[model samples]
Target: MASLLSLSTVVSHRILSLHPPPLNRSLLFVKPKLPFSRTVSRDLRMRLHSQTTNYGDKEHKPSSIDSKLNPLEGAGTKNLEKVVATILILAQVWSPLPLFGLDSAYISPAEAVLYSPDTKVPRSGELALRRAIPANPNMKTIQACHSTRLFTFWIPQRKPYGTMESNVKKALKVAIDDKDSILASIPADLRDKGSELYASLVDGKGGLQALIESIRYQDPDKVSIRLASSLDTVAEMELLQASGLSFLLPQQYLNYPRLAGRGTVEITIEKADGSTFQAESGGDQRKSATIQVVIDGYSAPLTAGNFAKLVTSGAYDGAKLNTVNQAVITEDGSGKVESVSVPLEVMPSGQFEPLYRTPLSVQDGELPVLPLSVYGAVAMAHSENSEEYSSPYQFFFYLYDKRNSGLGGLSFDEGQFSVFGYTTAGRDILGQIKTGDIIKSAKLIEGQDRLILPAQNNSSST
Candidate 1:
């Protein structure tokens, strides 16, 4: 046994010296004493030769090299043969262990922004409408300036309940189990109002009270009606909350007219046929009918400001109304002011300020702070030449019908237009209005203090 071990060591050294360079340096030396076979198979010899040819010398062809090395196949050399054969077999199937860490494949910012799961472009009707409008080169710099975070303009303090009136509506939607928690969460400043609201909701016999009773009675139909009516209180409360606008108007837009806060525009309409609208039981039989719109500067300052300025200038006075499928648009060029058109302004939900000239991608989960889904929503008509700008004078009252709208009860043009206000009063009067109805007079009754006009152009054309 001692003699055999010594002979095997010498044969291993001889084999290592004969192969000057092996595929792997560690594979060149056989340290372990393995049993050996007198005759090595052709298959094993061919595999070792193949490995050498692939990893080492590309020019070395597979031939009878094992026969020339057969001189070592003498007494006690079986151990060396077994060691080389075992090492070669293991090397053929060996692989490096996999690594694990926090590292992952990288994605560029620009590419990430463009990436989306939606296969189609402009998935919603509003998005498609906005994209159908031609892109203006002049707006490139302005869009970049507004979207970038470099300038860091001061965003207005968010109201405790919410910035936009819509936020107040969402805050009110709560399960019965969460009623106490919601009531407790009201801000200190609004505590009194919140308490009054809570009392009215629980005991006033209105939609909220009815909703709770319906749930207790387990009536699905009544619950549905009460829930809808309860949610609708948001529109009524919006007008009463005539609180100041919660967002800051950028100084860059000061050159143009802007309303930094809420304003009320009262428009009196009369039939072109000179007929009086039916009056309520206690109201006077006036020939002209009146409607009030509460313009929101928080969501759309520029658009609301421009409309308010035009109202003060009497641009809409005596303007003829043209009825379309789902909207009542003012006739173009009727008291049309030749002022610079305001860019398409839409304040996205969860955003600090309005996005100028760009419309929200509603299908991509972006919605406006002032949604167009409500009935009697007021918005500016798109410019005849470019959809990127709102027409300076002409505007419309959207007659929203849930049946005619897209999924989720959103208006077809939900995010396409600049919705600055809603018809707070006389929503029923909208259905009574006919084509060719005349806006007998238009006036800015409130929010004159919030209107900001340039010194040189104070006539209120825009």
Candidate 2:
């Protein structure tokens, strides 16, 4: 026991002497491996024996040896205590700094959103649809830089400012400052109208200038109302400048019916009860009313083309309307007239062409060019036998209600169907139509020249 005690005293002294005070604590605590420990113990035993032998030779007495070892043990204990106290002081000083000084390390909401991988997630149906449209390279660049387009698209998705006035003023300033770029977006024939709208936006009586005036008055409600009016004008200017159907259809799918540009479809509705239809906008009541849907072929050429062709063929002349939850569906028209099924078509955002026979995964952040979340969205129904194709004769007008939508204001069926068009005019009439209402007539009012039939391509080639 005396030898063991003395050996520990000698080892501690050697550790303190070889490694300075600062490193002694670390060297002492590090658990040596089995072989290293055995070697170290053997070397320490030899050194201890040599020192003990020298002391014995000089003193020639056990009492002298005990006196010397006792002092060495005391010194080793004092050095260990000092090392432990230094470690404890460091722990106490640095631990509190993390709890007190790291508040600034947390990221802000804007920073979090900016760095998010899913930043392309759209907040509005219109914005989603617009982003999905595959256009000419020049047109896409112009659309991205257009002030009115940015203002209209950004307002719905931007982070909230303290006041709506700030949001409106910021968006308006962006739009007003880019007048030259905005004018360039307009078609050559529409530049005169575009210039007039620009003039109206800057200084007209009820334009965005009026919004600025309302903001100056410090009336939030007036600012809100005028902001809506100004945005409406901005939206009109954007529509006038949009380039339609600028990309070419894939060569393999060229044989299928395709509308190369935009088309206008007008449907006349009549009540089943033979009652006069309620007129919108204070117009006189009539037995029949007309609603116009502007069908886009750019994003959904095959689906929109099929729909336009059916309208031109008088397939829906006497079809019955059936009302389902949040939708107004047309009869299948299978027994009355033959219909050709088209592959399911959806153009994903940032993609060049529509993916045929595929449905977008909305949960995975895939959004369609024509979102079905709009109140008057028009989409083809799924084929009776297969979900991979659309029921050529049956279509529906979606009655989108935000109360029924999921996150980002998208409908439950946002990217599932082939949304060919929207009920641009007479959207109010959609809600009034009953289950037994008749589609008295459906006509393609415009864009026949833009229809590229399979035979027309063959004839041109020959």
Candidate 3:
């Protein structure tokens, strides 16, 4: 009966140990895997002992029991203290949690496990874990964890103005040596981005004004300016040989009377391949021909005599048409025609001459001998106004367009130019002429101070 009672007691104790009372509701279900020992109640301890005896026939080894009990034995003091210290340190660093006053005695086994720093065991993962915690909870920790990111945002942003100003001054100096260098110094990226701004600051009108102002204020005398001048002298001479003038003959007359004898002349053409040909008497044309006025005895003898002198001297050879107005006779002369002033021929002083019965009449097949009446006829050219007359080696042609007549009777009344003859043939050639053409005097009758008129063949000759 005594052995059976001991066996029943042992079985009851084993059953009680195997089926211990439920854990406290406030305790954590999954405790932290902290490096700490565990502590069992007295009731749990006795039940464990009985279960050990009933589990196997052999006695439980003391070393095994000691090994099993060692963890619980030390959990209450040294191991628990280390765990609590680790948790406190971690809380202080990670958050703003108060660690000054706390009852560690009331801390449960599960709560004690929470204080362990198992999550931060690895060195690299500690920083990351700390960062995950709220920064407001632990300002110092967050700052330490994200020092690089915080510093980057906290720095001030700017390029020193002093440095920029110095660069500008240096660039300006370099520009003095080489104007383009100033543009080169500008950063390429900025220039490309702010091209208009650069242009305004550099070479635009405002920039120029600024530069000028700078020069005036900084180096007054060094500023530069340029000055300039021009001169022209126009002297025109006109020469005329009326039956009344002799010693007054132009130097051209004295030199080449033969030229002065002729009525009109051509000088130069102002066209390519002869488009609008010009003559001494006429302005411009597409084609042209030459005309030679000869002093014949049948014409006014005294006039012919005076003309023959100019022709023989070659004065009128290259003379130009001085003036030409429509319905007004064209005037030609030697020398710069403007230089020679001819006095007007006044009417005969006293008209008490004897009267003759026979009237001057024209013969058969003859044209009446009348004073020159042709208007704008080919003649010599002269300048505006003057006295000393010497022909220029140039000429112009007069177009008989009859626009100027009522001003004065078409005669040598102006004393500026003289009309000797007209262009009879090759009028059509005038249309094919341009500015310049050579004017040569036709050879006169040998030993005769007159031109040999062509036969009345009626054929036009060039």
Candidate 4:
């Protein structure tokens, strides 16, 4: 076996920096000694996460989006809309291009109606949708920002979830309104190459994994694909910029596994009384709401499977809105997180979580059953002994409403909690969720028969 000293050196090198040398080159010097070398893959998946107290935006000089990304450099294409559509589709499964995270799930009705794209944004304060556009018109950010609106032209009209389609249209319209940033944070080279790569997702070319590979392919530093998932600090961002990193690390706030989904599931949440009431100051009118989930059997199968089974079996029925953590802006905080005697529907989720979770520095690479950033996103609770994803029962509703999160929408529980569903219909009902309220029932009304439920753990639920 290679000396412990050798392994320590490699760990040290990667921990300090988000980017690591290519795998083959990294292991080149380590002579094989024993089967123990297999441990290298497991150990190397450990990612170093970084956070900033400076929730402030950087002072960026206004420049052409094309100048910064330069996507059109080698592309001989003359059509602007097609070029933009291709790049807009190459998304980080978890990468929040500023808009993807704050869709209807995150937006409020009043704000959604009154909100307009803001051209003037603070230079050094935490960046906002308003500031995503640059002061200069010809800047790359401006073009790339507004370019997302044209995606409707390229994206197949059919989407798995109607809500996703609606959210995409709403987000794009807003992005176009302010010359906003879509998948604009990536480099021009990747953006330029993304159209072809993005199209490959449908033609059986590749899915999220392909886009991730493409991002690494554009890296001049030869950063490892797995390491590419780490969160880059400002200092690390500067380091990547200095080393010519592929994507703008600072702006990649929402980072998770980059995988697509098979289809959608509509989870109908029936109020205890099956009745509605008006609020004192005019609130949600929808008595019952459907928590729509894109049964992402592709990304986190175990998590998704467990959730599907529970919904189909009516396991979550009568689950009360036990707890509420205001700081996280979540409803129904799982009350009394019981021990994980819950059958374990084992999956490769944690094993490959580094490829998904961002802003989270844990070694486990498992992705949540669903993204927690969206509103009405239903997620399982966290446990003390097991990993953040050992969810069997219990869930919550995330409520983040805004075009721009500003300082109000920081979710500390994103990678830590498992979100398996999204709110589609009756979003207004979310306002009525309160402590002591009961989840009369949770039924998979749309895709009940289609869901892949997790098998009961025969031998300890493996």
Candidate 5:
């Protein structure tokens, strides 16, 4: 069977599936007998993603993923690894990236396990015992029992009883403090449980959850805001900064993580120089408008606070309202569609979860308080280039209620952008506004203390 299976025969030719290996050499993709035997080649794994379009439901069903392959000799083992190659072959033919209704499009193998949470412990006949995970992951009170067979494809090798306990603890501390201090801290006792410690850290409370918490949760404290209602539509938005907007084309700017925690503020938008107006009032006379925005300080502290601080500090002054496509109000620099042009933010310690600022959204059993589903909804403008919609100081105003216009509750900007504040007053001003208008003044009249001023952003995209 091993002799019969070749790349040409496996792919181009319709060879029968399920090539079981020799009875003794029957293997799992899990820990092979030799260390040199990697489950998947780096190139093939990347190709798997490069060629993959859809992820969820594209992978073979667990029941269908039978690990049967021909046992190979020396050179064959080195060249055509049967397990990953077979998977790649099947992946190329059937192209299964979608496994268990999940389309995890990253390089991390932990994604599937994190999303697929099954706490059921295996019985004596089963593969391994069950360990209970934390319900509210941040809650420090997690029941600590070690389970071996949960989301893994193959049973992990048991380390010698106490060989690497201290090493794992040190590694975990490094992974936690270095990569993510945001995760709830673990107690010392939990560190003693072999690789289970590492498993728990990444299983549910790691980078994967940061990306997908379809069920959102609200903070204990809540801040409700009221904004004026009226609108327009444009695709480009502005990222207001402390210096206001200097030139539409800033060479580079500092990048930071989103402001988190909760607070309040009043955002005021004023006119700027070189401003032209075609007021909603029948193209009447020169119109001067002051827009006041009240943001719920308690919700989405990082995003809301960042905006509020910029307003209070007068960084948004002189910013241009550059784009008004139909009804969307986008404040791009120089009337062009572009962000501040800062490179991708990379943490010094090599964390990839958040490359830039973004709003907390649909996850942990909750919904967003501010969504651009209605007229006068204010949200941060983000780049459409990357999977992340979080941008520096870009935000815009939706001129009309998209939901009433027949988009259901989902606005074109709803899930992607972060809605932090609204036009609490001066809705009529929004009507009079046109592109190329300068923000004469953007001030924060209240709730200065509520804003969490991030430690001057030390991270850079350079």
Candidate 6:
């Protein structure tokens, strides 16, 4: 039988002979010492001169033979042959016929150095190696290595659990079996890293210890905790703003003319609750009351105009203060009106200019603006709608105190209702009156059509 090297050379020669030679070449020659050299030369010469030769023409046959024997012919064929020859030479140098114990189960020194991970050993060699080693002593060495190192290796020929997936599963099982030991074995410097990996494994298995272990990853300096706290605060503020609670940020105060030239009436709220507590005439007694507000446009034109339009022909009269919580700006019309209410005429909040001339500032103490300032100011109420411009008729008062300089000095027009007349006096009186207080008769004061109060007793008291 031909040696493996010779057989390889014969195969190489057959592949080279299929291609044609380039122009201006007569013959091809390859060095003999090289494994594929002689066969390559023969093949290349055959391809180069075959085109010029005719078997029936004896004269041309000699030229063909002479061309095939020469080394300078068939440039293209020669170059191709040289490439094949080089590959064959490399194959011979890299893989030689085995001498003794050639089919060892362990990787050969040469192969270990030169072989890529993708290279596969022949099955025949694997069988030979298995037969040579009785009872496979190498298995003990493999098991020992597996015990010491975190990794495991397997020969491809070994049946049953030789696949990558199987090996990985095995490793995982081993790791989990000795989880605590593995964690303890890790160096101190790498404990955190090891802990994270361990936690991940434990998490998959549903363990409280794993969850608790994750906390160790948090910064011990409290920086991460502070950052988380800040984020929570910001998220809460964003939620408030989204919920229409941001309008309470501005001060809310309502100023309207007292009935019949009695001077302007001012009501202030210091909380989000629509109800405000009043101190008794000369005592510390407190009471809560709801104020009915009308927007007239006679005294404070801007304030009255803005307030009147919101109430009557405009859009604010009956709008709801959709964002009132207890004790904060009970009601206020300072924010975008359309957002809170819908009116006969759609009016924009921008139309209501601030009337800063009156004694409306908190500095004046007429209306104290406070943190929960939605208590008792006039505002349009509306139903919740996707478009935000659907509030009408549902109005509340902001009891919270706020600056009202911008809304205090506004004048009212003839046809509008008083924009923000105070109901505190009425509320106070009503509060003091028991639920059974009977009204004998009601009448307007002599000539003042706007002055209306509880009728005084003309009868003598016993």
TM-score of each: 0.50, 0.59, 0.23, 0.37, 0.36, 0.18
lDDT of 3 by residue, 1-462 (tens): 224333323322222223212322112111122111112322211110000011222222111122332233344553543454455445643553444434243333323322332221111111222222211212222123223222222234532333323333443343334434333433455444334533443454334234344333443222121000000000000011011121233232232222212222222212333444445467554443454333222212222333443444465444322111222111233232322221111111011111111111111111112112232233222222311221222222334221221111122112222223343444434344432233334334332423222222111111
Q: Which candidate achieves the best TM-score against the true structure?
A: 2
Cα lDDT tens digits for candidate 2, 273-380? 877767667788787789998888878888888888788889999998877547777765766664577878888776778888888766556777677767888888
Tens-digit per-residue lDDT, 1-462, candidate 6: 334444334433333232322221121211111111111222222110001122221111111223333333456755654565556444533554432232233324423322221121111211111111111122222222222221222223332223323433443454456556655644566567656645543343222222223223432223223223322322222221121111211132222211221122222222223333455466443333333333222222223233333332233322222221111111232343432222111111112222231222122122211111222323322222311121222333333222210111111010111123223233333333222122221122121333322233111101
- Of candidate 6, the 10-residue stretch with the lowest lDDT total is 409-418
Q: Cα miss at 125, model 1 (Å)? A: 21
Q: What C-alpha lDDT, on a 0 to 100 scale, does residue 33 get in candidate 2? A: 18
Q: Which number leads on lDDT?
A: 2
lDDT of 5 by residue, 92-175 (tens): 334324632223432133222212222221221111101111112221111111121012212245322232233223333444
Which sections of candidate 5 miss by over 4 Å?
Answer: 1-286, 326-330, 333-367, 384-389, 402-409
Question: Any residue pairs clashing in model 2, and if so which?
Answer: none
**lDDT by residue for model 4 (1-462), tens:** 334333333322222222222223122112222100111232322110111111122221212223332223334432443343333323311233444444344434433321222211111111211112122232233223223322222245442233323433343344345322322433465554433332332122222233234333443222222122221111121121121212221232122111122235554444555566444458665555554544443334344555665556656566555322221121322333221213222222223222322224222222222334455555454332344234335445556433222121223233444444455555556666654456666655554443433233321211
Per-candidate RMSD, Å: 28.1, 26.1, 58.9, 23.3, 21.1, 41.1
lDDT of each prediction vs. the true structure? Answer: 0.54, 0.60, 0.27, 0.34, 0.34, 0.27
In angstroms, how far off is 8's CA in candidate 1?
Answer: 70
Cα lDDT tens digits, model 1, 201-294, are 4455454556546555655456456544543332223222334544566666777788876778899999887776876555665567889988
Question: How high a TM-score does candidate 3 get?
Answer: 0.23
Candidate with the larger TM-score of 2 and 3? 2
